[model samples]
Target: MAGYLTTHVLDTARGCPAQGIQIALYRVSGNSHKKIATAETNADGRTDAPILPEGKFAVGTYELIFFCGDYLRATGQTADDPLFLDQVPIRFGVSDGAAHYHVPLLLSPYGYSTYRGS
Candidate 1:
């Protein structure tokens, strides 16, 4: 199968899907990053489409920046000027170009966790 990338976000503290969170995908090379795609999470906490679709797939280092500040504030979770968990960046490498990648985030106002999902 052709490769692609998908993501999901959940507000662990609120026990609900993280909606309206902005997500940016970037191709990383050493110190350089080139943004390739952007998406917003729906009510289901998933992008309407794969963040990185098959035609645009590549094998290399990549970074996903999840914009959580707005969601936190909108949901009354923000408490300070600088959020402890704002733009959470997860950098990972894709070793195979023909495999699907699912990255999921379990998030709270102060912290977050990510893992490679099915």
Candidate 2:
């Protein structure tokens, strides 16, 4: 079976879900950017719902912007000089709606990593 767009964020430093993180979904609208949707991570470090409906997906470039600064601050994980990675945008293209796009984030106070997942 095919999958749809999904993501999970893990706070590697705290070894738990990166909750309360602000996330934005943007599509290249004209020569500028326009937000399609916005969501905050649930207790499980996942959006309450899919960023976009499964049936609405099409072949196009999209961006997932993860706001980690406030999340780090709220958790008291790091303060001044914290290596917060603001605007962690994962830009990707959807070739087919039939396939799923799982983009998970494994993050620390200093850095983060993301990849296409199943």
Candidate 3:
């Protein structure tokens, strides 16, 4: 079996896990995004488990939708006019599963960053 795709979101401005943030995993279909799974972050700012398990991992393109608007609002960190990028989408590819692929997002109300983690 191959590995899976997962992500953790951190509210960089608040310096904490982005708890209760809405998240969605989607696979890009022809012209639209196909929703696969929807979940929320826990107290630790991570999904309760791997977003996708070993047997479920696939070698293709994937996108993670993070609802920063709700996260910031819930955490009392929303900007004056909110952020233009309320929904941050990170599109990436999963080529191999033998290794663990952890993607972490460090985000703020106005900007965010993502990288391949352990």
Candidate 4:
């Protein structure tokens, strides 16, 4: 199969898809970083298209930054003080360009978790 990158966010606090959450994709090399794309989560907490489309998939390190603080506030679940979990960044490597990479995040106001999904 051709390779591609995808992601989804779930609002663990609200038990629903985290709509309107901002996300950015970055290519990381050593201490340098280059942003490749930016998108917002749809009603299903997913981007309308693949983050790294088929032909664009490559073997390298990348990061996905999720704006959790803004998301929490938009959903009316923010605290008076600073949020412990503001931006959630996930970094991972791609070794094969012929496989699918699904990174899904389970997010809350103070905590979040992510995993490789099918």
* Best by the TM-score measure: 1
Question: Candidates' lDDT values, in order?
Answer: 0.94, 0.81, 0.82, 0.91
Per-residue CA lDDT of model 3 for 30-62, tens digit only, reads 678888888888999999988877887777788
Give the per-residue lDDT of model 2 (tens digit) for 1-118.
Answer: 4436787799999999998888888887557777888888899999888777676666678888999988877787777764556668888888886787888889887789998888
Top-lDDT candidate index: 1
* Colliding pairs, model 2: 3-100, 4-100
lDDT, model 2, position 60:
78
Backbone collisions counted per model: 0, 2, 1, 0
Report how far residue 57 has shifted in candidate 4, in Å.
0.8
lDDT over C-alpha atoms for residue 24 of model 2: 86
Candidate 2 segments whose C-alpha is farther than 4 A from its true place: 1-3, 29-31, 81-83
RMSD in order of candidates: 0.7, 2.1, 1.6, 1.0
- Clash number for model 3? 1
By TM-score: ranked, best first: 1, 4, 3, 2
Q: What lDDT does candidate 1 reach at residue 46?
A: 98
Point out where model 3 deviates above 4 Å: none
Lowest summed lDDT across 10 adjacent residues in model 1 is found at 77-86
Which has the better lDDT: candidate 3, or candidate 4? 4
For candidate 1, lDDT tens digit of each residue in 6-105? 9999999999999999999999999999999999999999999999999899899999999999999999988889888889999999999999999988
Candidate 1 colliding pairs = none
State which candidate, 2 or 4, has the greater lDDT: 4
What lDDT, from 0 to 1, does candidate 1 have? 0.94
TM-score of each: 0.97, 0.87, 0.90, 0.95
Model 4 C-alpha lDDT per residue in residues 40-68, reported as the tens digit of each score: 99999999999889988899999999988
Tell me the lDDT of candidate 3.
Answer: 0.82
- Pick the winner on TM-score between candidates 1 and 2: 1
Which residue ranges in model 4 land beyond 4 Å of their true spot? none
